[model samples]
Structure formats: C-alpha cells, structure tokens
Target: MSAADDRLAARVRALAAAVEAAEGRSDAAVSADARAVVERAGERVAFSGSYTVVALAGATGSGKSSLFNAVTGTELARVAVRRPTTAKPMAVSWGSELPHALLDWLDVTGRHLVPSGPHELSDLVLLDLPDHDSTEVSHRLTVDRLVELVDALIWVVDPQKYADAALHEGYLKRLAPYADVMMVVLNQADRLTPEELDRCLGDLRRLLDAEGLRATPIMAVSALRGTGIKELREALARTVANKQAMTRRLSADVTVAATALAADLGTANVPRVDERLQRQVVAGLGAAAGVPIAVDGVRRAWRKRGTVATGWPFVTWLARLRPDPLKRLRLDLTPGDHSPTEVNRTSLPKASAVQRARADQGLRELTDAATSGLPRGWASAVRNAAGDRRAVLLDRLDVAIAGTDLEVRRGTWWWGLFGVLQWLLIAAVVVGAVWLLANPLLLGLGLPQLPPVLWYGVPAGTWLLVGGVLAGLLLGVLGRALVEIGANAHARDARRSLEDAVRAVVTEEVFEPVEAELARYRLARQQVAEAART
Candidate 1:
C-alpha cells in the first residue's frame, strides 16, 4: 500500500474510535464499508502482474457482441439476432495461455478459441460480459461485477439505444469515473448514414463528458463491414502494452468501493437530553418542595430556642413559635391513632395532581430538546423506557419520606411538669422544718434551748431550700426546651434529606437514564446522513 493509502486507512480507523468513544458504540456500517473497500484494494493489489482484462458492457441490443467479434477478428461472441440474447459471458483470449487468475477472479468459466488470424494484439483478454439492461437481475449483477474487476471497458452502443435511460441512469452515470479506461463504440454504424453516425457519436461523447468523463474516446464502428475494427484493436493493444491497464482497474475498484462506503454515512437520528433541561428539573423540584423555606424555618427555631439539656417548660413552648419544617412544605404530619409515620404531601404546592402533570411536562420538554429531530420510533422507545424509570423514581421518593417518624414520641410534654412538682414538695418540707424550730409552743415541751441555731440554721435552711427548688425548676425548663429544639432539628434534617433524596431519584435514576437513552437516539442520526450520501 502507498503512504496515502495507509493514511486513509488510519484516518478511517481513528474515525471509528472517536465515534465509539463519544457515543459508546462502534460504527458498524462504517466498519463494514471499510472492510469492503479494503477487500477491493486487495483485489487490485493482486492484479499488479502481467494481465490485461477488457470488459465489454452495454445495454441490450447495443451491439456489444458485434464489436467484440470485430476487435478479435473472429465470430467468437455469439452475435445473437434477438434482443437481450447474451445469457452468459464469452471470453476470447489473445495469448496462447489464458490468464487463469484473472478469469477465476471474474468467475468467467465459458471460454472459446480465437482462430489463428490476426495475432498482433496477443496480450489482451477480451471478455464479452452480459448486458446490464437484461431483465434478469443476476445478469445485471454479473455485468456490474465485471465492471469492477476488468482492467478496461468497451462501451458498445448502437445509434438507437445509446441514450437509453437504463444504460445512462443505471450504469453510465455511475461508471463515468472509469472513462479513462473506457471507450465508447457506436457499433453497427453502417446502418446509419455519415451525418447520423456523427450526431450520435457526438451526443455520446457529450453525455460521457457530462458524467465526469472529459476527453473520453468515442469511435464509430461496423462489425459487419469491418469498419474501425483495426483502430479499436490497436487502442486495446496499446493500452495493455503500456502497463496502465492494471492501474486504471485499481482506480476503478477504488471508486466503486468509495461509493459503497459513502452509503454507510447516512443519518441515524437519535434524540438526547439537554443540560439546561436538567438544571430546570432540579430547580423546579427545589422550588416545589420549598426546601429553602424549610431550612430557614429550622435555623430560626434553633436560634430562638436553647438546647434540650435545660429542663424548662416555658422554653418548650417557645420552640413552638417557629413553623414545622414538614408543615411549611404542606406535608401533613399529624400522626394518626396508629404508629408514627411520615406525613403525606397531598396539599403541597406542585405536589398536587395538576402541578405534578405540569412538572412531568416540563421534564418531558427537556427530554425532547435533548433528543430533537430523532426518529419517532427511537424517541418512543426511549420515552417508554423513561416512563418506567420515572415510576421507579416516584416510588423511591415516597418510600424515603414515608419511612421518617414524624409523630410525637412518649414523655414529650409531661416529663417537665413532673420535675416542677418534685421541686415544690422539697420547698414544703424546708418551710415546715423552720416553723417547728421557731414556734414557742413547740419549745415549751422541754426542747433544748436552741441557742442561735434558729438564727443561723433556719435562715440557711430557708435559703438552701429556695435555691434548690429554683435550680430544679430552671433545669427542668432548660431541659424541656432542649428536647423541643432537638425534635425540631430532627424534623428539619429529615425534610432536607428527603428533598435531596427525591431530587436525586427523579434526576439521576429517572431523568439521567432518560437522558442517556436520548443520547443514544441522537447518535443514531448519522445513519440518515449516510443514507442521503448513498
């Protein structure tokens, strides 16, 4: 292979790799097309030896058989009188030995003897290929295969059928690039006058030129009258003798392969998800849940109230001044007569049925934008898959929030009251003790003269009793306040956690997978573009 050929191959391989990396799937059609091109290249490589294969191709009744006979100076190719008569190919070899490799490659088994006549052009192998305009598709395919493998082509045309639509549209337009190795013969020219032949040959040349075959050689010939046969033979012999025949064949094969490979570059439309849509989804969800509001409520409640360690009843009531986090989002958490459970967000903004529908529509719009212009079938498939995922996401969100304990626990409010009553009982005992000691009536019963014991002990005992009761009451107040604060904090934390969880479930598990599926759809668009090129 040449350096340029190597570079082209490397470029194709790199394209395959880049496509695979970006889209996570290999280009199957591209690889298949490349393989086919490489196969054609290999065939051309094998033809670089001593062989000159000439292909005779044209539409039915174009007189290719007549020209084939005139070029070889023999009636070898059956000059059928009927239209579309050549059912199989006929090979006429010039040299004593047949080019077995070329013949086998062409799959031409039918061979004939060229009688010892004009042996001047002894190196050329003339193959009378089947008509491309034959009714049988196999015959047309055979002609097409020969067109790719042959070293040179002779397009024999009758004046009447030279401009036939099938010959021009199907074959001439496609094979125009090989005109360097092609020659157009207006065969059976004796049937037409000089003016008619001139006009037809001129038009044929113009058509070939229009098909990208500038300076393509055109000759007028009559196989019956032996007109221009020697010139055609000389042209064929010169083409083989110069060793440019194989080069032309290789170039033709390259063109054929390139054309086939180009077909695979068609559009494969697949839709995807846009990042803007994703951001919108996240923002909408955050707004609907009122997460920021709930967070703010928790922060205010935390600052206004003290810790639960302080046992105070008044402090607990102070904690209630702030709003409940769940309540702020309108997620009702009033515990039922049964066990404690999560509050349902039936009345929450955007959580209502109509609001949910709108949110779903927003998500769908984002998904649609990501995968815009993708095929309806592929889009539907991805949408179905996303629908399944959204169900799972909603279920998971419900489960996370539902599992939180939102009900008031046991000993919540009564514990602080019990601490207050205990302090009061201690105060009563201290007062009774003081009164018993100071009373003159109680001392008359031979009680020892409590000298100054009442003065110091009674006051000290009274101060001790009041101080102990106040300390217990303050502790009770602070402790109860702390408990309410802690509970409030827990509720706020649980709400935030649930918000995040639900968002992630809807976006990652639900939205992101949908996005990936949409990406898959977008990547498929290459197939459509490829088809257009083909």
Candidate 2:
C-alpha cells in the first residue's frame, strides 16, 4: 500500500465508472454484490491504512475460533463457548488506537483492544467469523458478508472435513480471485498420526489447487496443543508488515466485478455503415414519399408550359387554361425561389399503411446488418435510438417534400420562336384569302386585278393559303417532339433533387442517432477493458 497503490486506485476508479455507466442500460453488466464490494473497498482504504483485517472462516466443527485465539495469544474468541456467533463479529485490535470508523463500517459491534506492546502482529485486526455451515440463516449471512469484506482469510478445516464439497465448491472455487490473500489452515493436527497428517495435508492441497488456488498458502496447526501456532503468528506478522493486504483484496474485488462486466459486453466490432445500404434506404423511403408521382408531375408541368407557348396560335390560349400538374401537389416551387418553404406542406397523398410498413422493415434490416454480431442489449439500444423519432417521421417527410425545388420553370426558347412563326403563317393565309375574294370583286367592278405569283404552276393565292396551313401544322408536330425530350430531362433533374432531400431526412432521423449509440458503446467498452486489465 505504497506508491504503487496509486495504480490500484486508478483501476478501481475505472471499474466504478464502468458500473455507473452500465447502471441503467442492463442489469447483467455486473453482479448485484459488486456494488457492495466497491463501497467496502472505498471506505476501508480511506480508514486506517495500517490495519489488516484478517478473518478466520470455517465450518462448525473446524475449531477455527481456537485457532484465532492461538494466533493472538489470548482467550479473546471464547473457545469454550460456540454460542458467541449468535452475536456480531468479534474484532480484537492490536494497535494503540481503536479503528472505530473502520470496525463500524464492517458492522462489527463486538470490539476489543489489546494493550499497546511490542508485538509482531500489532497492525493486525483479527476477526473470528461465524461458521459458514451453520444452519441458522443469520450466522451463514454473517459469514458470507465477512468472507467478502475481510482483507485476508485463514480458512480453518480439520482432517475429517478437509474434502468437504460445500467448502470447496461453494466458497473456495468461487473465491479463486482472492488467492493472493487467502490461506488454508488444517486445525487439530495433533489428533492425527504424523503419517495421517501428511496424507490429509497433501489431499487438501490437491483440492485447493483444483479449485484454481494453486498459489494459496496452506499451514497445518493444532490450536489446542500449540503445535504450529508460532508459525501461524509469524505468517500473519509478515502479512501485516507489508501493509498491502487490504489493497490486494480490493484489487481482487475489482477484478471480480470487471470480469462480470466484460462478460456482459459483447463483441466490439461494430460494422461500418455502407453507402449502398443508405441508398437502398433512400430508395425505399422515396417510394413511400411519392417521389415517382412528383417526378411525373414535373414532366407534365414542363410539357404544359411548352404546349401553352408553342401550340397552334388559335388553340394556345385553351392550353393555358388547364392547371399545371406539379402545382396540384403543392410541390410547385417557382424559379428563383431557392429556399423552398417547408411550412407549405405538400398536398401529395399520404403513404398507406403498407408503404409505412415497408419503410420500417427496411430500416430494421439496415440496422441489423450494421450491428449483426453485437449482443442483444447493445442492439436493442441502437434500435431504440433509431426509432426514437418515429412518431414524427411522416410529418418531417412532408416538410422535406415541400422544401424541394423541382426546377420546372420556363420552357425552352424554341417554344417562343415556334409561336412567332405560326403567327406569321396565319397572317399569310388571311392575306391570301382576302386577295382571292378581291379578284372576283375586281372583275365585277371592271377594275384591273393584281398579277398572280405562281409556285410549281399553282395559283399564288391558293399556294399561300394551303402552304401556310400545312407548314403551321408541321411546325406544331416538331415542337411537340422537342418538348417531349426536354420534359424527360427536367423530370430526371427533379427526381435527383427530391431524392437528395429525402436522404437528408432519413439520415437525420435514423443514421445519426444509431451512430451516436454505437459511439457510446465503444466508449463503454474501452472503459471496461481498462478496468479489467490487471
């Protein structure tokens, strides 16, 4: 617990932050007991740094209380009476001052202080814990709490119960993370012959090793006959002298919690967003938004303008009477109105339920592909983010359509030119009809008639009238063909611009939120890894 503990402090903080980060997201992020472990570590470290709280835990017949008394060289644990566990834990402090705050935080109501003296175990605060195998629920609970909170454990077992399954499976195996500060004591070794003691110790060592505690220290001591009491005291003295047992125990608890969190965190490889997927989404939403209908309107609107400008001079006014197709859908943004008004919601037909369903399904497929290998919790989170703005999706779509400038403005210059030429041909036909009528009048009045100009031996008046009418009809046909081509190109431009607007809306409503959630997951994963590193 010196300069290097600074690193331990930082690691513990990271683990605490991770637990806090995952608090509301998922319950499986960490075990329920991990919070208590974190709280204990924080309070213990802030208190007396010199004191090492070592607990002696065992079953009812293990004689662990007597072993505790032997190590302390005092009758503090009441070896004759086993009913002492009916009370709280008994802590005998070996230092001059009482660690009232520390013991109170430990919930140890029973406290004792030995006179300050030059002893090797002065920095130790030894606890005689309740038997773990007690039938009473309170005693078992007491043992369970102290087992997790104590800085070190000296598990006292006898030759008869050294291979007990409850002790090995329920406690030892589960506590493999704390092996650095845990030890096994074979109490009452004097009752067994030397050969029997060797056999029992070897067997117990094998059991501990199989439980993933290969480095856990083992000592055989007969508490009643004082056989190995001196060696146990020397072991505790060395454990206390370093003043790092508490730090190690807290670090172990951090490991246990971090392991649980890391297990709950699934794979960290979030797939990159594919533009094709985005384009597919845009295409799907475009259908739902009636983009095809809008483009058709654009084509018709362009042709309508052309017809009013280039149709037969006699019929052009009738073409202008009909309403433009795009204006009917409220998608008609006039030229030079660069910033379309989103408030002018489109009159386009609302999407049917089937169309809405397809849009939703497409979005789901896209998200699933993006987070394919992620765990259920994170995937659910991302899905939640994607759907967060769903209630207003249609409303926002209306805004996007209304704000699109469809570029269906003035027709090509050929329409105006054709209209002027058709007007000139009509004038020629009128003049030729007047001249033909006047020729008869001149003859009846005995006046000279004008000479008739001829083309291909036909009367000039007849040719003027017939040729002008035919030429006007041919020019109208040619103008219609040109307008058809220009309308298609205009429709394409309109479709491209509308699709761009729809993509923006989809990105705002879906992609941005999902990516933010993915970013959040990455940060949490990095913190978890930092906490998990030993």
Candidate 3:
C-alpha cells in the first residue's frame, strides 16, 4: 500500500473509535448516520485488500449493464434476461474463487467469475446493480444499499437522459462528498454528432459541478460501439492497481459522516464554570441549605459568648443560662467531629418551598448554560443526565453545610482583658463598702473615730463607690458596642466559608458531569476532523 493509503486507514480507524465514544455519550439520533459509516468502514476494510468493488449504477434505460459487459469484455451479466423487477445484484468477479463471503456480506446471492484469459479486469469485483429508477420499491432499496457499500461508483447515462432529474437531484447532489470515488459516464455517445456530444458533455459537466461534484470524472462512451472502451478499462485498471480504491471510498464515507455529525456538534465552543456562575449556584444552594440561618447563628453565638466575658461582672452569670446559638443549630460540629455513633445529618431545618424552588432554578440554569449553543438532540441528552445530578443535590448540600466550620474564635481576644478590668472595679466597690461598715462597727465598740479621707470635697468612701460605678457602666457600654462589631465580622466570615463549601458541592454534583460531556463533544469533533482529513 502507498503511504497515503496507510495514513487514510489509520485515520479511518481513529474515526471509528471516536464515533463509538460519541455514540455512548450522545443522543442516538445525532450519531446514527456517522455510526453506520463507522460500521460499514470496519466491514469494508476487511475485504478491501483482495479486490476493488466498482458498481455500475444508472437509471432504467441508461445502457449501464451493456457498459459493464463492454468493460469486462464478457457476457457474464445477462443484460437481456434480467427483468426490471429484479432486486438482486449480479456480481461478476475475475478472482480465482467466487467472492462468496464478500457477496454474502453485501447480501448478493447471484455471482459469476470470468474464465481465465487476459487478466486486465482481474482484481476487480464488478457489480451490475438493479435500476435505481425502477418501478419496484425493492429494486430501488437494493440500489440504495449497494450504493453505500461499494468501493467506487460508475454512473452511466445516455445522451438523452444524462440530465434526468431523478439521477442528478436525488443522487448526485447528496453524493458530492464521495466525488473522489465516483465517475459519470455519458453512454450511447454514438447517437450524438461530434458537435452535439460536446454540447451535451458540457451541459452534464455544468450540472455535476453545480451539485458540488466538480472533481468527479466524466466520460462519453458507447458500450455497443466499443467507443472509449479501452480508455475506461485503463482508468479501471489504475483504480485497481494503485490499491487505493477502498481507501478512497472509505475516506469519502468518513467525510460524509463527519459532515453529518458536524451538524449536531453545532458551531460553538464549550461553556465554562466561572466564579460568577459558581456564585450564582452557590447563592441558591445556600438558601436551600439554610445559609442565612447559619450566619445568624454565628452572629448570635459571638454576642452570646461576648456577653458573659464583658457584661457587668455582678450580672454576667445570668448570661450563661442562654443556649449557644451554633450548638443549638448544630453548625458548630464539623463533619470530622462526628464519631461512629453520630449521625451525619445536621440539625438545620429543612428548606422551605420558596427556597427549594430557588435552588431548582439555579441547577436548571447551569444545565441551560452548558447546552446553550449545542443542537437539540445533544442538549436533550445533557438535560436528561442532569436529572440524575439533581437527585443527589439535597444530600450533597446537607453534607456541605455540616462540613463547614462555623465557629468564631477571633472575635473574643479582648474579652479576658475586659473581664479583668471589671473585676478590679468590683474590688474597689467592695473596699468602699467595707470602709463605711467599719466606721459603724468601730463607733459602736467605743473605739477612736476614724478620720474620713476626702477627695474633691467628698468623702473618700463615697468617691470610691460612685467613681467605680460610673467607670464600670461606661466600660460595659463600650464592650457592647465592640461585641456588635465583632458579631458582624464573624457573620460575614461564616457566610463566606459556607458559600465556599456550597460551591464545592455544586462543582462535584453538577458541573463535573457537564464537563465530562463537553470533553466527549470535543473528542468527537477532533476525531471527525481527522476522519474527514485527506
């Protein structure tokens, strides 16, 4: 085989693999034709090495059977005996043995071999197909089947019907991609004068070119007169001798499959999962997972802890009676904190109907974006797969919320300092109270009356008690202001972390599958391009 032929075979193999992968990931309708090509290519290549199958195809009265006999120089195919109603193809090969296996695959039952003689037509399996324009439905179907399987096609037409609508519009227009393996024969040329033949050939060439078969070879021959018979034989010999007929035919099939597959692939690139998209999805999931409630828990828990540490020292003990906001909501426990006996589910309330609706909309938007520019069939498949993704979302969100660390430790650094200062002020008040009581006890016991220490024209005991009271009140007010600031800070932090966790969940449960499908799509396109390459 030539280097070009080897390259084509390798490409066809790669194309087959790519088509198979696409079928598994794609909708059946989108991939049906391309997959059929892949199947046909595999079967055709196995028999391609032995003989090149060149089929004679034409309308009912095109003298196609006569041309087949003229090229092979034999009456191997009974043109006079075959009826227009015959659907079975007559295969005439010059091989030593009848090509039974190959014909079986082609579903051909009638076969013959030319007697050993000059072997110019050897290495060729020539088929005289049934009339494509036959009145019989089965005959037409048979032509269609063989058309797909043949390695090369020789379309015969008489000067009178060379421009027939059924042959040109119905077949040639669609077969344009297989131009390399196809040729048009203007048969019965003996009926036309030299000038008439030139005009007719020109018209035929124009029509074929208009149908995108500009490179398709055209010949004017008379099978009965043996006109241009030897040249046609030489062309057939070259097609057989180069051993590239099968490769060319399969390559054209690849082109046809790739072109069809490209329709479903659309002219768009894959969509991405950006930060903005993630944030949108996370917002919805956070609502469904009680993110607002979780943030509120963080704020309240921060203030609750702060109250005990910085409230009036005498009254702060009462603050301990309040429940911890995080503990009550079970947001304080990370997933790793769970023991073997603990359940994985959190104590957060179930999402309300409104929140659930919001989440579903978000997930739907994701799939919509993923399939934005894709064709209907592929988009439909991706959406169906997204249904399975949606099933696990609620469970995934629950785990995400449970796994987030909602504790606020950085908000409590000054709490100890405030508490110690409050206690020092309390000691001053206690000292003042003791001094006042000592005076009463000493006077009653007839001891010497203590001289009162004065400060700013007031009794020292009164100043000590009053000043401590004023300072402690001022400090308590300042502490409450600080607690509010810290609570807001902690609330924002918890929201960020929870949103981040929710983002991770959606990426795994939602976007991963979509990306996998996108990768498959890219692979299909790449493979098709390779298969369609020359």
What are the Cα lDDT values of the candidates? 0.62, 0.81, 0.81
Candidates' TM-scores?
0.58, 0.84, 0.82
- In Å, residue 139's CA in model 1 sits off its true spot by 3.5
Q: How many residue pairs clash in each candidate?
A: 43, 0, 0
lDDT of 2 by residue, 261-340 (tens): 77777656866668888887778788788888889998998888887777777666787888888888888755443356
Clashes of 2: 0
Candidate 1, superposed: residue stretches over 4 Å from native: 7-54, 70-75, 81-84, 90-108, 111-126, 135-153, 174-183, 190-195, 209-217, 224-274, 282-359, 373-534
Candidate 1 per-residue lDDT over residues 6-66, each given as its tens digit = 5444433433333342232224565454445446556755744666778888878888887
Model 2, 501: alpha-carbon shift in Å? 1.7
Candidate 3, RMSD to the unseen true structure = 4.1
- How far off is residue 197 in model 1, in Å? 3.3
Clashing pairs in 2: none
Model 1: weakest 10-residue lDDT segment is: 525-534
**CA RMSD, predictions in order:** 8.8, 4.1, 4.1
For model 3, what is the C-alpha lDDT against the true structure? 0.81
User: Relative to the unseen true structure, what is the C-alpha lDDT of residue 110 in candidate 3, on a scale of 0 to 100?
Assistant: 77
Off by over 4 Å in 2: 1-4, 13-44, 81-86, 115-119, 267-269, 333-343, 352-354, 409-478
